[model samples]
Target: MRVLILGGTREARDLAAALVDEPGVTVTTSLAGRVRDPALPAGETVIGGFGGVAGLRAFLRARGIEAVVDATHPFAATMSAHAVAACAPPGHGDDPAGALAGDPAGPGSVPLLQLTRPGWTPGPGDDWHRARDLPAAADRARALCPPGRGVFVTTGRRQLAPFATDRDRHYLIRAVDPPTDVLPPRHTVVLDRGPYTVDGETRLLRAHDVRVLVTKDSGGALTVAKLDAARTLGLPVVMVDRPAATGPVPPTWPDVAGVLAALRGLAAGGQAAPPA
Candidate 1:
């Protein structure tokens, strides 16, 4: 059985690792190549985008990929959309006239699964201002922090452009990669990755004199320390909500173990048990 895992997260890596030793199964993981140097996962790996929906359908048909598991970030809506389209039944896919046409009639019977972590929920002592998108989050951040007050931004490099509109407020932006576009005049960029500790995050908040925390609700242990620190410091958080899923909604699992069990069932030519 051949499987293509659209992976980047730790859960994706874990799933890939679990599948590596399984007999009669071949695994290939694909990365979006957003980060400069991402940690390699087990089995074969392909970096960069698969173009668009048309390109993806072509690749899936050519590669004989039997199953597709989308383990991309929650914010990667575009890629998720393309993946769903690429795995849909024959003429029902996004590209009806493309390379998928060469396949047997009613092709793309592959099982499509999405492995997404749950988003964080606000708890006691958390001053959460939820925004539907990044732009709204920036506006909330601006409102929460007056001029001269700093805002700690952990919303990634690409989304930083919206916050740049507030030139007067200071921003302490942290990202894995450096921003390509020009930042606001009062912004300081910290090129860093996370698995951050509460103590480290506390010190960072203190050093920046941040009054507000701006971040996406990208749920995981690695970046949750910042939220804990914000709660500790009594700072308001402008949390940007994840985008709605596009195309067909596939079965989703919140953790790697669930995904592994499902994949194993699929590889054995059995229907995957519904998520618990």
Candidate 2:
């Protein structure tokens, strides 16, 4: 059995590790290579995009990938869309010709399992302002913070373009890589990765005296410390929502344990996951 994991998250790593040594299984993981030094998963790993949908389909066919598990970041809408199309049955995908958008023959060709963590829910003492996207979040941040006030931005490097022209508020940007996009006039980039602690997150927020916290809705328990820190200081958060999923919802597994079992079952039989 061959499996291709579209991975970059902790769950992806955990799943790859669990399946690497299983009998009759060959697991390969793919990364976007956005990070300078990404945490390597256990099995075979490939970096960078597989072009677009057509390229992905060729690669899938060439590699003889039996099953595909989409474990990309929740905000990775484009890649996720490509995965759906590439795995769709022949003449039933997002091709230039053939299948229309809602064709019944489309959706899944190879067995697909979705491994997505749930989004964070607002809790007591949380001052969360939901934004539709980065530009909207930037506007919300400007509204929440006074001129010359600090805004802590945990949104990734490539996402900084939307906030570039805003010169009123000072930004404390945190990302694993230095931002490639145009930056705000008054901003400091903190290159850091996380499985962060609330104590550390609190200290950073306190040090900057931030009035507003801006972050994406990339959810998982490991990354919730910043939200906790913001809540502790009674600061307002500009929570950018995840881009909506584009196609038919695939079978979903909330955690790595569930997906591991499902994939093993798939190797033994033909059915990989429960119905959508």
Candidate 3:
């Protein structure tokens, strides 16, 4: 059986590692290649885009992929939709004269499984402002605080482009790695990941002279330590909500144990066999 795993997160790596050495399983993990220093997966790894649904379908057909597991970040809604569209049956409007969105039909369409981390919920005494999008988040950030105040941004590099597009405020940007593109004139980059301690984030905020923070709704204890740190410092945060996603939600496990169980079930039911 051959599986294509869409990954960039810890969950993605865990799933890929779990299936890498399984009997009769050939797992290929795909990364978006956005991170400057991305963590490598244990199995076959491919970096970059598959050109959306059409590209994904063709690749699946050619590679004889049996199943697709979308373990991308929760914010990667576009890629997640492509996986579903690639696997979805042709609509009534599909014409013989024209090709569909994804690849041509093969032995059968691939099955899709989703592995998403949940979003965080607000707690008492937390000063949180919600925004509809990145631009809105920026607007709220500016309106919520005064200039020259220290600010910590954890919204990832892609979204940061918009915030820095027309902003004149100074910021302390924290990400897993340095940004690929130019930042705002007054922005400073902090390369790190969290589970950051309260004192660690507090010191970071103080060191950068930040009075506010901005982040996405990527939920999980591993990355949420910043929230506690912010609250402890009495800093207000702007949290960008997650976009809607597609596919059947996979079971959540502390680690890869649950994913292994799901893989075992797929094998036992003979669903792991590649389509002819």
Q: How would you encode candidate 2's per-residue C-alpha lDDT over 24-66 as one tens digit per residue?
A: 9999999998888999999899999889988888888889987
Total clashing pairs for each candidate: 0, 0, 4
lDDT against the true structure, each candidate: 0.83, 0.84, 0.73
Per-residue lDDT value at 102 in model 2: 17
The pairs that clash in candidate 1 are none
TM-scores of the candidates are 0.93, 0.92, 0.83
For model 1 the local lDDT of residue 229 reads: 95
Q: Could you tell me the lDDT of residue 246 within candidate 1?
A: 48
The TM-score leader among the candidates is 1
**Tens digit of per-residue lDDT, candidate 3, span 1-276:** 788889998888888887987898999999988886788998899999999878887888889886677788888888877877676544511221111212324434565666676689889879999987888888888887687766678987665776666455778888787776667778888788766777787788888878778899988777787898888878898999998533433233334555566556566653322221
Score candidate 2 by TM-score against the native: 0.92
Relative to the true structure, candidate 3 reaches a TM of: 0.83
lDDT of 3: 0.73
lDDT for model 2 = 0.84
